[model samples]
Target: MSFRARTTAVLAAVTALALGGAFAAVLVAFNGLQQRQLDASLLAVARTEAVEVHQHALRFSDRPGPAANDIGPLTKFGIIYEDSGTVIAATYPFERTPPHLADIRHPNAQPFNFLFEREHMRGVFMPIPQHANTFLFLATSREDFEGDKEYLFRAMLAAVVVAVGWASLIAYWMSGRLTRDHRNIAAVARGVARGDLTARTDVSSPDPEIVQLGSDMNDMVERLAELVSSQQRFIAHAAHELRSPLTALYGELQQALRKERDAAAYRQAIQQALEATRRLKLLANDLLTLARTKQDAGESPEAITLERMVEDARKLVADLATSREVALDIRLPKATVSHRHGDVTRLFRNLLENAIMHSPSGGVVRVESEHHGSMLHTWIIDQGPGIDEEDQERIFEPFFRAPNAAKTRDGSGLGLGIAREIARGYGGDVQLDTSSRAPGARFLVVLPAS
Candidate 1:
């Protein structure tokens, strides 16, 4: 699900939980308060009835018609009396006249309060002080108690319903605001992915986290756009550079082959054509290697022994060095240094070939390998005219030939660029070291040890 929907769902669930807990607590507290009030009212009624009975007991001998005055204004009271037995009475007479005062007498009769019927009622029984053979019973019906409780229950239920409705509305409003921000972020991300790197999310909230997220996303888009533009420019420049050499080679060959020529002229033309073909092949290979290195940089690395790779590179370039009359000096440590083999080898071959190609006749080209900590370092130093300090940094850029080297030989100048790309692919890098003690260029390759 989308982030906005998920966030809304989580918020809604939390709101429901909070509302349920609050509503239940309110209901419980309301019911408890009502019950306490009902008990207090019942106790007040019982006390009033007890006082009336006590007064009537004091006048028992003086009264003529009945033991008590016409049941007092507290007439809704249900009553029971016990002398020889039990008798029930009420202000309002019943058709059966209730049991007389002989049915409930017992040795264990005691005064107590209890609830009776659906209505909560309180009952009390006490012996008359002056009337030796009489006891008075009084009870108050809880109809008022029930009526108040019913009203309270209805009020509480209405409040809960209203509270829930309000909570839902608030939740909806908050979730809508959150969802809108989430949608804006998602839309911006989608646009960026579709190559619209200028797209950015609107930051409406003053929340720090959201504002930071928007800033970070915009920064990432800007960086991506720059990288894409740089890559396009590089590709266009590389194509132009390659086309120039190919066009020159094609024109030279066509012109050389157009007329009948002496053997020496034909031989020279063929040699020039072969040199052009070599340059083209070298350019194509460097470009392909650079592309492959970039792709492989994002892949899982494999183990390769530095010593073995250096040995292989030396063997591959041995013939070229011999043909050029350049002396090869290979020095590898006895212990095995492991790394990403393919990239390491590519870096080694490029640096070695660059040194050999640039070195003057009879010049020595040295290849050395060593290990330090978690890194493998390789150095290729040629005893040719060394690069200037200012040009060392830019030497690895594609098609960037140093002034002296360009004058000395027709070098394509992509070898160092391709070498550095491979070096970087293996979590390593290559750079020209102008501080070399010898009077030639020193290219250092540092790779992560496996």
Candidate 2:
């Protein structure tokens, strides 16, 4: 069933059950009250007639037929002698034989009581205390009581149906409001699934939780859109970067192959091709490392000393520093950290290489590390032209080469970006601290200290 219909049905059923129970209780109590009143009225009539006989205002012998004086609503069935069970005075002539005394017997008969039900009539047989030998018999039709109960039942049934119908209508309206809100949210989600990232469940309701849920869903979609856009931008930039070296390598090889040349000329052409191939290989490796660091799974972290990592990075960049005619001044502490050995090694190697490439001849590329509380802070300071403030923020973007570095340096810009990615993978970060140094760039790496 639809939500509205189900809600209406449940509400109606519950209301009906509640109303039915309450009405049934009222009917039962009212019926009992009516019966009590009937019983009291019968007793009162019996008492008054008995009192009149005792006061000499009535006589059984004089009133042997229908009563000449009214004795209230109950019809008198005449006075009887208890010992003989014979009618002495009757309000009307006996049309049918009376019940046998033994059949009317009550084991513990009270003063105003006997078993007297016949022909759809019910009454009581009462004995006069003043006249020990005499008893009164009176009865009335049960048609009036039955008729009142039937009328009450019909009225209650009508009231119940009206009440349930009204309640059902209200329930249906409320359910519609709730389901409409849900439908709006579902529509927004469907739009998002169809790649419409701008779609949102901008719903307003009295319900706080539903409103909060819609807000959270909108936030999630916005974040997902941002991530997908960033991925696309990265792919475009990577393609542009890879095409440069590939085109160079392809052109050099094509020229060498066409129109055979002297050995000296071929050797020079092969060397240039090898140089392009090496640059392409380096770019490809950096791209692969960055992609791996972005993935959700890889090698688990292990305990490795920061000092040993610095040593490894220094050795890896020794050739580059020597070629650049730069001095490496290493100052590292004996601190251990929990990190993937290969990732940390590559991260430090990239930073050292970048520093060495940027430094002028005879300039010092200083490496320093320290343990501070729960973090290991490392600094790689290069005596090169400092990064401009405008480019600091975008310095770590993949394949984003700074203007100065692009003009003077012979290296891809992915080194610093890959270094930052690897550092962040270990719950650490790498950033340029321009304010902390002058006439050079200072790159800081912070990792968890074990």
| Model 1 alpha-carbon drift over 4 Å, by segment | 1-188, 196-230, 249-275, 291-346, 356-364, 369-376, 383-394, 402-412, 421-429, 434-440, 447-450
lDDT of 1 by residue, 1-450 (tens): 755456556665676567667766876787667555444444454445545655654222221111111232223444445465645334423214543444323232242344443445544455554456666554445445456557766776676666656666666677778667666787899998788878977787667888788778888888988788768867886888788778878877898879999988988887887877887887787777777877745335555566788888888889988989999888877545445566666678778888888899999988887887878777888988888878876777777778888865555567787788777765788887656477888888887766
Best by lDDT: 2
What TM-score fits each model?
A: 0.54, 0.70
Q: lDDT tens string, model 2, 29-84?
A: 98777667666665565566666666663444332222212233534454454657
Q: Relative to the true structure, how large is the alpha-carbon lDDT of every model? A: 0.67, 0.77
Worst 10 contiguous positions by lDDT, candidate 2: 61-70
Task: In candidate 2, list every pair of residues with a backbone clash.
Answer: 66-91
What TM-score, to 2 decimals, does candidate 1 have? 0.54
